[model samples]
Target: AERVWYPLWDAGLKLGHQVGTVAQLLDVGAENLETATSLLAARVVAASSADGEALVDDLAERALAQWKGRSRQNLDQLQGAVAERHARFGEVAFLLEPDIKEARGGLRDVHSLFWVEQATVPILREAESAGLAAAFEMLLEVRVELHRLTGQRADKLLLELQDDVAAALGLADADVLMAEVSAAGRTIAWTGEGAARRTLRASRRRGPMKALSGIRRREVAPGLVLDDGRLELTDDADLGDPLLVLRYAASAARHDAYLQRGSLERLADHAEPLPVPWPAEARGLFVDLLAAGPAAIPVIEDLDQVGLFVLLVPEWEPCRSRPQRNAYHRFTVDRHLMEAAAEASRLVGQVERPDLLLVGALFHDIGKGYPGDHTVVGVDLLTTIAARMGYEGDDVDLLVAMVEHHLLLPDVATRRDLDDNGTIRQVADAVGGTVLLGLLGALTEADSIATGPSAWSNWKAGLVRELVERTSHVLGGGDVGDVVGGSFPDAAQQALLDDGTFVVRGEGLELTVVAADRPGTFAKVAGVLALNGADVLGASAHSEHGRALSVFRVGSVLGGEPDWARIDEQVNRALAGRLAVAARLGDRSRTYRPIHLTARPARPTMTVDNVSSATATVLEVTCPDGVGVLYRITRAFAELDLDIVRAHVQTLGSDVIDAFYVRDQFGAKITDPEHLAEVELSVLRWVAVDF
Candidate 1:
């Protein structure tokens, strides 16, 4: 303790003498010292010969004076420091456990205001200052309580400790404590960020003529004008316009610009509230803001900073700046909603009611802050809000349905059997019609993208699109056969076939095989390609009227160019029963092991579908992709006397998703449950064994 006091005393004395006054000693830590857990408590004793009490009193006055006449450079230095701290914190609202001191909009932001005030910087005006001071006090109390509970200088409000801290603070529970903390954090962060913006604005060269010369003001909407890239009020606008704020927000979003701070302050002061059932223009503007895609994020942030978002959607308060204590999210509930809306905006053209999709996206997860399953809670909350916004009858129902079943598409696509007629019918019936199906499909993508990268993949996207298309057919009152019979090769791959008679395009050896359809066409072609030292990466096979057009994308297994002439001869021999694919592949298997096994293994699944095609049973085999896996599966089909009609093979990273459409003898769909089970079992055995 004495060692600590000696250094502080020496530092204070040196700083006091250098400033040439005892009153110039500034103590930034004193204001919150009583609540500080880690700061050492010490007293500086003076010599018995000196006037100790008088010297202390003089030091306080000089310290206050040093803050009063700060130079321009000093103010800039403070701004830079705050900006550096802001960068260090990054976006923390959605961190699984947030640091209560250094996180954005946390105690540090509140402390920055004290520094700003101490420097006599007038960046924060009267209203912002009042708000910030109250927020600072709240955060300071939380920090003090946290330190007391932990018995250390702990600042991270981790999930496990939140309940304990809440109990110590006399709060009802952790949720209530978190709500209060989030509110304070949002206020402090928003205020500090506004001040930082203003400081940058203040540092710019100031001259009305020079500002005007850069970019003149232009009217963007009825009551809004773009004043040098920032939005502001036009001279002819009515100050009391109920829709004025929303209109300006929409215009700013559309142009990828921001609302001027002065304009925001003016709007906050005078903008009138919309009627109970919001007018057409207000609702339209809300949709427009969402439709602006990524451009809307900054505009929404500006609205939130200026308190306009809460005014527009009063229910937004509990969620604003709220931390999501989960690994899946990368943003707070409010930020995630904005990002979802932006992503939905990109897919708006896909839906019939883009406006409803936009609104639904904006409020999809509004119930995360409340208790219960978010989907159920969100449906009730968004329905009420939609009703208040003047949506009625089918429109109100549509919004409710959208919220309730937002996760329907992705869930069904990934987990359920998409090739079953019953599966497609069930989804179609649940979502009502094509309109809702389209909207739900778009919302699913938007929501997943906002959740995080791990929540989506190309394979997932392909699955969802297939579900949507099949469901659309059902809703259109078409039989399963229409959907099944119409399924064709991917348009891009079909184009690749028509461009040349027998072309091999890709570096990975794409071979276009055009031949008369036979009993083991796919097996022969695949085995020939394999024997020629060409490893099949993927293949697409299509057949019509005794003729087959197949494309195989292959890489070199032997690290050399494939012998095309030998491949042609072997394919013919295999078709003629003069070549054995199974025996040759079995020999090759002994030399190499599977290379692309997942770091975390998953059980291989073989799905047999009879409803996806009119003439063939669809077999989708998903497994760890490795050398000769395709050859083994094709050989198994040939041994089962199954004729391959079409095959779509795709490799996604370490896994292979290969769909083989096959017909039994007499070219009929295999509907017998026992036979289908046998086929699945056979494929599983082939996929499981090495050879």
Candidate 2:
């Protein structure tokens, strides 16, 4: 009810009145009150009146007339109110859990439409109004049911409560309930946004004579023209041309302008269907639209709202407004695809086939809406889509492969050992060649970025990049050692190893430790860094003769930069057995807890892989990420008399995946079954200490 009375009170106070009573405010009439306030008061009075409906109707008409009399002055305030409301409540339509009352596309958006309509001219078409009304009713029903079930006024449709809400409403399950909610919210949000833009544009227009004289129309393409800053079709443009829709969309994106709603409606109603196995020109235009980078997203969204986008790719309908019921994805299936394509456009220069990369990114996750495995289903779906878009046999196959292997890079990079020859060979075989590898590599980065903030990180990017380089070497017929040999003891590190002296160098977030090769050297450095408030993002170790060199990439656990001078001194003292590294780390672990502790911690697991690497046993440990995880794990290996040749440390959200290439005291892989089992048990025991 605040939406109704707050504006009225604010307006009355502006008119130099206390507004102590509703009667005083209503008696002020439309002339003295702001248009937005008058409209809000009209709705409240009309809803509350029983027998005075006719009187309320007269009040509403007077408010509309007054608003029209000073449309320009009123429009700015109304638009500002709408923007402020959106700021308070987010505008995303397909959140895993949605706010039913305040979120964009929620009941408040419907109310915003009503306010905008009363303040300006009619913005929604008759059909659009009907759709918006239905959407509002659905959201209202859900909100009412939520209130009844919870016995309290709760607006957010929480994930855990969705099932109970769905059952009360006689829906099949939570997914079904959420999908319907997404559809309704998207409709209301899109309609509301369009209406707001149109009203704002109308308010900015000049008087008829000045407007006609100053109107600027510049042709952007064959059918599209920039008419008064909006992309629209010229009077002589052809409507029946199949490729015209793509051309218009591309021009709109390239010009960075909003597509005129009237022109969009005309195109949706009259444009012919693109022929199957589309001609080169039509395909080129479609690609060009996708290649417009971030600008293409809003243009594609506008086309989707009018049903024009679906006409080009019918497979896109199922994905539209479909919620991804997980914390990892920040957008709906269709929106994520669009975002991924937009991100991929920026990385086009990195690949040999930018066209395939762009198209592949757009369709990579298209099968999430289907029932089967998304990757498998996506491969099938893209096969048909690629062929229809006029790709040749090999191009179609490559696109299909891209969807099938879209997640391959990130999954392998984060979860497997990149130092292993077998791992590199496996990836090279799956990717087939460098060209597809390049495409998938870029797609992996784009897709992860689009998923959510937690999905992509510099550590993950490094792993993927390393994997791609190693796989590229193998695919190009180079020996695996050619790539692996170049790693570790690189020119800078080899110089540190050759020094054969204790050296602790600290620069920014990177720390390098060179010391005499000894048991627990790596563990001491890791524990010292952790105690110094340095979160070890990644670390690598190498040794030649009696000297060992370790390079660590770290970030501050408490934010800002780490105290490098203190860390450097502490590392030297710990290596000299004077700093009590383990005891200090244990104390810090008791005091410091990870900020993002999940309800269900991942069950710790360890795998001893001997076949992946020829010389060292690849021991991979996965556990919930906590304080000093790498320190504790390496300490266990040192206790077992194992020497860590190399290590890859990565943190993915609440979990950490650490792969260590280790060897026995004699520099031999731990091949005995009992020894392997002991290694797994020891690491798991140490990792569990922090948990």
Candidate 3:
């Protein structure tokens, strides 16, 4: 029904004893010619067969055995050998070793093929001839396709390898597996040496007979074998031209790629450069990029999203790096700075939305370009360049803000000592608002990782905690209570209970608040009740029919208020002049009719309704008004196979929202919103949350 095969090739030495009978017949001059030919062929087949077999007397004769045993013990380094030359060949045909270490049972034989294909897909391709590689423009095409396949993981080496055939063709760590196929369909000995030689031949693509078809020789390297064993071209013109330079560089990259894996010291004497901002023009373009702002980004050329990244790093101190004291530092301040930036990008790649955030982390310290007043000098320079390049508005704003706030992480980390509030205030000040702490937090996490673990400690987590608190407060959660409270007039418009209104004339924070009246009239204020002990917000009023009423709404004021104390005093004086003002110096209160907002739960039971199912690591989350963070608790249950029976999410602002839900998997209504909140808070701390 089924067949098996084995192979053994030992460079034509100590041949199996079957050949012994053939040799004797030849020596005695009594060979039967045709008979001898058949006999020799049978011997070779038997040698490769997995085991010796005998004709069975009965169908169920389990007593018969076909045995084969290992005669030598040099197969220990087999996998390393195969992986080392993975880039050289494809469709490797080899017998399985008696034992497989990493996988279990059939996993070794079946699963390995799939795994090998996957790992090498990013770094290697089906390359038999350079002609095919060139015809497909395999490097560029593969990269685009690979990036699509990887989706969000595009920055990782795995994703980058999809387009890296030029380099992947050279990664010796991967290989295609091949199995010896024959007509006999019987067992055979393993030919480990044959596999190795075939690997070398496949790596070269074509033998001497077909070398000209694809891998033609052309000398490109200087001081190396010119017009000798390897490929080469004599004209210096190929070196100077941009298009030609890219081609040759790609060629070199691929060539070195192979040589590097073979453990060859250096593949070439020159560097392979991608098409990008000319190193010679870097100074002016850097300045231009700083200026062009957001518009400049849309017009970027030569550089892809991955390569456009640049990092700004600190000057190295001799005493600071204890490990590298012995080696002379070839990377000076400028070069080391570049390295730091690169390191930072590598770290940021692992975070969510890293593409957007890493750009700021890279360019944040670029303001050091000027001799003095980096903030002003850099800002001015950036705006000028951006204006020149047709960049303005939000693009310019984003860049300027990042560069301006770049020092926040290091400044806090290296500070003498900073309390939680101080750290939070600093973060809020840099980001323009506490609500943006999530974005800033992502940036901070990337920066810390970019610099490596030695750069931070548990003490640094306190800084993150402060920022989270402020951010959560801004997100309509946490115990922010009222950052800047304002006054509401007593009696809703002759008790009409219809107009939702609030009066906050302090600190430019005018908002329209509306919510049904409940038990906690004072405590349930959603946002900005008081800040720095002053009501820096406006008044709000809301009312429905007499049966259901609450207060929430704020006066809309542009550019916000300035100096709550000054505004409060001015308001008091104006109120005293206008009406009977009983406003005391300290105690203040407001009563207003209330309005209600209906709550609806999200439902996706039918297949048509539930199309997308995303499996993501929970990063950051929130809950609806008067509701705690049910999202986090449900997500935790999801992790533990706890199904959410019902869930609802309500968006209140651009970066803020809240969710509520029931998880039947736990079989109980989560009553303690505070406990849920605490769980969310602890989870936020345990993981530097992202989304």
Candidate 4:
């Protein structure tokens, strides 16, 4: 109790001249009863005169009016508050283990619905009240039980506690409990969302606005219309046509138009069920909707909110808001599938079969809700879904294959050696042929990009592309040698003979340094560059014929143009071993937090490949990224007296995947297993450090 009111009391002491006593504090609160109500409701004053009591009553009446009345000022304030809350909790439904109080569709949503209902216009009062009430009651009960079982103030319904909570609530199983909770959350969330929409429309009606010229309308067939920025139905609309729903959805998606709430409600309550073995037009429109890319997300969300999507695809229920229970996935299973399909739409021109790509993306995770291997189970489910959509036998076979191996590209690209002929051939055999391979490649990119930022990096993309090209080469009966030959540019010799080159490119400066090949060339270059107040974004290095060429992509750390002459002088001095690059870089590294040291385990991996190139041993490194990581890596190599022939550096979120081609002092490939192990251990240890 003291913790709750002490701040108010402390403020009173600061603001009031004589607020040391309790009675004096109450007097101060009574004089400013509105502030008191905001801080500690209703009990601010111990007793009051008749006139003071009447003043309090009047204040209460005004406060209620502000909350419940539809004045322009009140509605505007409400809108701002709603937007703030949406930003805070909009993605709560997708959490792996959601908080019962603060998460979207949780207890707060129920309260928000009540507040919105109180302020809604009369015509929109009972739009979905029954569902809202039921959801409120169920969530209140769960919240109470959750607090009791945990013997404290707990709101997150964790997986470990789900079974116990279910038993305590007299439920049959945890799944039943979770489904009930999810349903309640959705009900409250949808109702609140609908209320907010109505309030915004009401607020707009009072503002001075001009109607669009010529009664703008984009007709979807004969009845449905995008009229004046809202979806509507004409007088002669056919509610019995199942294809009308898909047509309207497709039109709204393609045109990026908002659907009217009333029209959505009518469709949800009265739309005709789609026939089994659905017609070609219906399936085509569904594909068109998916092909709209990210514009379709809003339409799909609106349909799901109004309960119309389930009527189109009943199999969607299991995947709705289903948690993936991993850090890598950012959305629920159904949302992830839709996002993947949307992402695939952006690459429609890249594939021979856009329709198949859309279908495969939508059904990629349909088996996640079931037990056993999801790939095999998803293949079975895809067969049924395809048949229901009236696909031909050959199309069904293709869809099954697509779903059965959706994870093939990313899994193989990241985990296997793409340089191996057997690896490329294995992918080709699994993919069947060149055409299917193309589709799989496109689908893989869409799926990975939609997974999360960390799931796909430039380096990973390059690896996947390489794998695909090599596989294509093999499939076309081309020699591996023909596909793997490219020469480094002669820029190094020119730069060595003169000054280095610095050019501004897209918000950063690209510095090209050329010098005689040495063990610590990269270290000196990176260190001297960092010492000049340059934040290195990326870099690449290559050395051949006793000459080294390096390019550093960097942005100014001090928000000004880099002093090119100073940078050039320092870099040269560092390369000549006159400057202590390591000590200088170490000093600068202390300003930034040691984020990588405390970061989640990166599962650092090292692979020494002797087959990729005959001349140099390729050391592929993957680990958590950090400030000055590249410097530490190159420094470690310099310490070991290993010359880096080439280096490729890439970062995806916090993870860094790099490859370095190196040789011993004698210019021989480090083939001995014991020596390779020592090198791998050294690199991994340096990578694990923050500086």
Best by TM-score: 2
RMSD of 2: 5.8
Query: Which parts of model 4 are misplaced by more than 4 Å?
Result: 1-54, 63-70, 80-190, 200-248, 251-282, 306-336, 363-484, 491-508, 527-540, 553-589, 594-601, 608-618, 635-643, 662-673
Go through the candidates in order and give the C-alpha RMSD of each one to the true structure. 11.1, 5.8, 23.7, 7.8
Show pairs that collide, candidate 2.
Answer: none
lDDT of 3 by residue, 1-691 (tens): 0122122233222233322332453432222322222222232233323333232122112211110011011122234534443333211111121111121111122222222222222223222123223322322333344445554323122212322432344432211100111100001101222233333444345346445434444444442222212223343333433333223223333343111111111112122442333343433334333232222321121111112221111211111111110012222122223333444444443434333343445444444434576566556655554443344476567656655655565444333112223333434455765323444555565445444343444535554555455544645444333331222234443243455433333323432223333222212222123211232111222223322232222223343443455444444343234421222211222222111121121221101111111211112233222211222233344343322321222222111132222222234443355644554554343222221
* lDDT winner, 1 or 4: 1
Winner of 1 and 2 under TM-score:
2
Per-model TM-score, in order, reads 0.61, 0.79, 0.26, 0.67
The lDDT of model 3 is 0.31
lDDT against true structure, model 4: 0.71
lDDT of 2 at 559: 66
lDDT tens digits, residue span 307-338, model 1? 78888888787778765644556677888999
Sequence-dependent TM-score of model 4: 0.67
Q: Please, what is the whole-model Cα lDDT of each candidate in the order they appear?
A: 0.71, 0.81, 0.31, 0.71
| Candidate 1 vs candidate 3, TM-score winner | 1
Query: Model 3 segments beyond 4 Å from truth?
Result: 1-356, 367-391, 413-423, 434-439, 458-462, 465-469, 475-691
- Per-residue lDDT for 421-538 in model 4, tens only? 5556677778877777787888888888888776786767887888788878877887665654343435443445344343222223767777787778887777777677665654
